[model samples]
Target: MTGRKALSRALDLSLWKGALTTAGSREAADAVTERAVPNEPTVRLTAVRRLYEVSTRMGAGRSLAETLQAVVDGVVTGLGFGIAVLNLRHPDGKFEVIAVAGSPEAREALLGTVSAADIFDGEFKIADEWGRLRFVPHERLPEGEVVGWVPDVPVSADPSAWHPLDALFAPLHSPDGELVGMLSVDLPEDQRRPGPIHRELLEIFATQAGLAIDKARLTDQLLAEKVRLEASETTFRLVFEGAGNGMATLAFDGPEAGRVLRVNDAFCRITGYPHDRLIGSRLLDYLTDGDAGRTRRELQELATGTGPYRFERTFRRADGQDIWLGGTAVIVAQGKDQPRILLIQIDDVTARKDAERELQHHAAHDPLTGLANRRLLQHRFEAALQRSRQRGRRGVLLFSDLNHFKQVNDRYGHEAGDNALREIADRLLTAVRHGDTVARLGGDEFVILAEEIDGTDLDALIRRVEESIGRPLAGIDVPVTASIGTAVVSPYSADLDELLRTADQAMYEAKHRDR
Candidate 1:
């Protein structure tokens, strides 16, 4: 069977020879045995030197396409082929050209023709044995048919540098004998039929190419993963450093608990600290109620996966001014064997909180004289009523009207009356105890709330109001006296309007008596 196999192989070689030319072969068995001897040592050494050079050059490829292209370049440079093409096998069991390298004119012409035919990504039928090799001589290939196939590869473009009249195809196979792809070669006219020695060299190159291709593809994948990871990290870094609010990471355990681990640019600016100075400093030093103990509890919550914590706090900047900061904190677990840490975000709320207090003051007080308006006076009235009922203390609500206030306005002009009213408002403020509430019910009407008073103290308080209002105005020449009346808030009579009405009726009687 081995002899028959040898005979069959010899017959195949002979057939190839005859097909490329009108050559005849010797007896089949004799021809097979004669061609089996090794070539000269010098030729083998020369091939070795060139192939080594090709191997080193092919190492430059970092991707699949570049590597496959390097393989084609190696075949032309190492094996001295005029042109070389690396083709890949597709899932449909057909081959398509992927890479090309050769003489300048041949490469350009062939590539142009291949592109026009869509041969790079397109499939072409080829047998499994083609992985062995096949040679097609210029004469055997009918110009009408084969030349027509590459109709666009113009011969007149650069006839001197482009002459590849004969070609060889050597298909590559994996170790498992599975066909991977093929390498096509165009030999010089003088050495159109390469010896067995040359063929053997081509096979060695094909094997190296397969291994190189695998490596290149793996490298390509690793580089792609690296690029994706770098992009993700860049995006996170931009958000952390560029955000308007402050952000920081803190140590959650050990002696370093509450220590600032890292702070972004925003945090640094907020705290008036440089990046180097802030790191390793305890965060509690800059925060109110942010001690190590509190931080540990926060860490515990994070370890237990509770949830994010939110609160308003005061942070001391480097300049020693306290700033109100609204903040959110959360524990971030770093997995087993790694200590968990805390993430926090803070925003300045000092301005907002101050604005809120100002709004409350404006809503409850008179804008002109900065005194308690009716709204605040009524609020005080309810509190006084509740206190008198609970504590059994006597309380009085006094109503006072400026006597002849409209007359002062008509005689001295409204501005002088305003001056007189301001003097009266000031006198009313000083006449009573600090605990008492004095309010203006618009225009010339004023009310005073005095609690925890006996009958004697209430009478003395009324005398003081009468004396204060009787004083001359600072800048106005009007004599503004007040018609004052008082109502006792009994434990059984807690109604606000009833007290106000009783006070009003008594004041009307005082005015009539003065008239």
Candidate 2:
């Protein structure tokens, strides 16, 4: 079957109207539909319709190679050419015979054959320009240089008759005016050279072929991009859902800011909440009340693209238990049409947090007395001094020592001495006011820091400590008494060492007086 007839059967002509609509050219459609004027030449009217048919067939969404073949076939069978060849340009500036028609032998021999760009340039140099078409007459042809696919046809006796060696080319260009290919035709069916009218029809068909090729290439590119996007999305889904750590995507802007848009199974497991219930819910809703306000501020800073991505936060689970999460978040800014998002990933760190708190408590407290040790005492002393200065309040530091503590150990034994020390520690705790710090500075020495104390309050505080310590021991038969000394602290209280020194000296004086 002829190539045009085969193509017509393969493509749907119902697409003709649709093709015209897609091209955005209502004029072409109008020309096809409009009735011919009175006494219009039957030849011109028939030829115009042929051009329209060829254009719509090319636009019927065929593959690029198929479309190129159809273009050459339409030129031969539809436009009255005995032979046609489409030479397509390559990146290296060479032209390859991609499609041919009119003669079966020519199609077999010329298809896939390449021609150097300079060879076509040499032919055009000697050819006459017929508007957009180039006409190379037999007499003008260069010697010893073959141009394109030349058919074995005999020369005519008449000077104006179409000759076998005579060449005609219509340059096919992209919409951008780049020469993408060349269409060469020879042996017009009338056995004469193509007139201006025939050249104009060929020019119009070439323009249509160029546009169709350009559109087909664009469609191929779009299809390729779609395939890549689908692949990337599949990879992302696998990583996001199968991750070991809890993961969630939150909206970072608009009315949905801070709200969870999606959560992986791990995140649901960590929060003890189901997937359906968590969507559109604020992540801060799961935070403990104590941490809510502070966490909200930090999240706001993070959303604004500031602050560290790493954080440790406590969240209340569905079962009313608190869990700690240590994780990092990635903030995705809003692009042209993209929504701002926060991709948060976390691991359950409740056990780690509990261990850390236990270690911190042990480091700050005395193991023997269960009271503040020297390290903790210094920290409290510094804070109290700051408050005293800021509030213009007065405080006092009371230093005390057990009288003859070594003698208690010697008479009652070291175990009994330990029991006696426990009793003294308990008494010291009760004797001090609320918020005061009582610390054991090793064996037999205890210090109390009392803030906002007046002269009368200081005197009363000292008497209470002596009375508390002077009581009988719980297990030891020996009596226990403590010599107490005090140092007044004003807003001017500067040195912790000087305060402790003054209190220590007074305690020794009291011990001497009591003896």
Task: Give the number of the best model, judged by lDDT.
Answer: 2
Identify the leading candidate in terms of TM-score: 2
Write candidate 2's Cα lDDT for 336-418 as tens digits. Answer: 34455676767788998999998998898887777898889889989988888899988888989888778889988988888
Residue 64 Cα positional deviation in candidate 1, in Å, after optimal superposition: 41
Model 1 bad stretches (over 4 Å):
1-239, 271-305, 316-320, 411-420
lDDT of 2: 0.69
TM-score of decoy 1 = 0.48
What C-alpha lDDT, on a 0 to 100 scale, does residue 159 get in candidate 1? Answer: 27
Candidate 2, RMSD to the unseen true structure: 24.4
RMSD of each: 26.3, 24.4
Residue 468 in candidate 2, Cα distance off native in Å: 2.8
Write one digit per residue (lDDT tens) for candidate 1, span 29-114.
23443354334554555565566566555655557777677788887677866557666665566555577665443444344222
